[model samples]
Target: MSLSAAVRLRPGPVDLTSVETDAAPGFEGRKADGEAALAAMGAELAELQERLFAEGQSGGRRSVLLVLQGMDTSGKGGTLRHTVGLVDPQGVRITSFKAPTEEERAHDFLWRIERALPLPGILGVFDRSHYEDVLIARVRSLAPPEEIERRYTAINELEQRLVDGGTTVVKCMLHISAAEQKERLLARLDDPTKYWKFNPGDIDERTQWPRYREAYEVALERTHTEAAPWHVVPADKKWFRNLAIGTLLLEALRGLDPQWPAPDFDIDEQRGRLLDEAPIA
Candidate 1:
């Protein structure tokens, strides 16, 4: 099965509590094996991404948007550092959404999101995406209940539009158990070098874990559409998380079957022109 299918959340009422955070759903590899596999995939991933970028330059409209949502210290940064880090930086666009600025707050929740979407042929990654309106907003009562309900439908519609316009949306939720999250948070506190990553607000958010889980479940169920489904990666194992997401990216790119664009000019003419002119003083 494709990695997307392996980690995809089935259609039904969602229950995150039942999922295992440490289980490597479809992979049978240990840490070393997973790392080795990712390394092997790097060359192919880079080549495929280059093809996609070239196609975009040649007028292809298709692109990809990877939306990664998770709780604090769920390894969003680490995943990008490892998996996405392997691909050529030129073909990738990454956006990390923080709290809304005043200008962002003035517009619809998706307004800022739309501004960051990938253009044709680029592989775009969202560290925390438009889901925040429904996830954090719902969990913290940041929006009216009625407004929250409306945003879900709006998100589904926007994603469908993106698909119609040739953008593939790959949504993932990095799931780590509460115990695992606590441990990660404590490790950050313990490591002075990671002090900057330590946030007192994250501990405050921990107080509402149950609420957040429910919010995520509802968001996953309501917005998980046929065009853009959600994949739940058990992220306690950092190595496996990287492997699964890396595979997801690989599957997405391969599905597009991006090929090198045909040279607009005659290849023979261009080759002769370049070869004959190369010895200029």
Candidate 2:
């Protein structure tokens, strides 16, 4: 099966434990080979993005939203830098959600999210998205059980509106094992450059790994719908993760198949005018 299909989380009950976090299911050969493939895919994605932007310039209504969710050290940042970073920055809107501010807490949980939705013809990325309301809220008891359930329905409805508004949503959960997370965190601690990336709170969060896993399972099952599907990307291997995301993005763009907008002015007339203009020395 294709990497996109292999990593996709289908509708129904999803057991996080059943999924492999370390395996590269749809890729072959060495890490270098995967990186090479990813680079090629990145080029294609850039071209597709240019076309998508141009289509929007010509009054096209479509856009793309890529939502990345994962545990700490699951390589969410790396995916953004290595994969999605290939596209033109002007056409990419990236929002990284941190703790909610006082004003954000005063509003609905999705209010900040709605404000960050990608504009028409741009590719928007959510480093951490609305799923946090269900994940952290459930794991940390930030909201009541009944309220958590309601958020699922609210998320579905919100995504439906986004789809109706010409935005295609692609959500991905980067899955990494506890052992792998430990290694990455330790490496960060040892490397002075990465020391800034470490957080004492991450250690505390790791203690509730089981609860977080269950929260993700519930969120994935509840929100995986026809309008917006979820992809559980294996992220222990960075190369494969990049390749997988690039492939999924490429496919989404391919499906959209955006074209260059038709020229408003007469092509022959413009060509003649250009020819008649003074030649450069």
Candidate 3:
């Protein structure tokens, strides 16, 4: 089945243009049956990733860029920890971008991200990427309105250029509701061991959920394009979110059809001789 058919994504009522400010229904925690579906999807994704890795080795060309952007506690780390665990690490790389360091801040925003792009025959995953410039900057009023708008346009063009240069871009926005986020935050606060996960600043951000929603809507609508479309995965149910993301990633990699490079010299005769002499040990 097509990825869309498998997930059965319902269109949000707010038009794409209005996604930033729109509060769509987030996926409730999965039902019991969702667990089985998630397992099946995980297996399928593993198989697909293996095939893509083999093809990537053969083709000796082509790479994939998977950009995962989400609000805090949207399961970005969990999804990466699980989904990527199924792939051959030698063929994949994950980069987590935090608040820029002094050196990173010295360069253009894309510079840090650009440096992390995948080489040929590999998959690169970006956790909280250049999109933060739009999402967080807008939320905190860090940049002027004119600058924010310009960055959005620049991001689209940059992604377009990457696609034109042979990097298939698969971007995902993990979607969760305010209530679910609250539950997660509270869970962290109530558990002594989980205290490290809670940030005092998170409380401040929670107050601005509505504004962040607006920021995301605008970001998604403006950034969504034919070359690099965004998949807004339902993240309230961690299992379903992972399943959907893994399914989408597997499909994208499968579509690439990477193949191993051809041998430079004939090996048939040498292989026959080696087989005949193999018992000489």
Model 1 misplaced stretches (Cα beyond 4 Å): 1-3, 275-281
Off by over 4 Å in 2: 273-281
TM-score, cand. 3: 0.84
* lDDT digits (tens) for residues 1-281 of candidate 3: 44434333233432333232123233333455545655666666665555656656666446788888877888899988877766768878899999889898888778998899987667789998999999899999877888899999999999998888778898888887777888999999899988997898988998998888889878877887888888777677777777677767777877876544467667997788888885755
Q: Which 10 successive residues of model 2 have the least lDDT summed?
A: 21-30
Q: Residue 132: error of model 1 in Å? A: 0.4
Put down candidate 1 lDDT per residue, 1-281, tens digits, no spaces: 65557799999899998888998878777899989999999999999999999999999999999999999999999999999999999989999999999999999999999999999999999999999999999988999999999999999999999999999999999999889999998999899999999989999999999999999999999988899999999999999899999999998999999999988899899889998886768
Q: Give me the candidate number with maximum lDDT.
A: 1
Candidate 1's C-alpha lDDT? 0.94
Residue 222 local lDDT, model 1: 98
lDDT of 2: 0.92
lDDT of 2 by residue, 34-138 (tens): 899988777789999999999888899999999999999998899999999899998999999998999998999999999999988999999999999999999
Better of 2 and 3 by lDDT: 2
Worst 10 residues of 1 by lDDT: 1-10
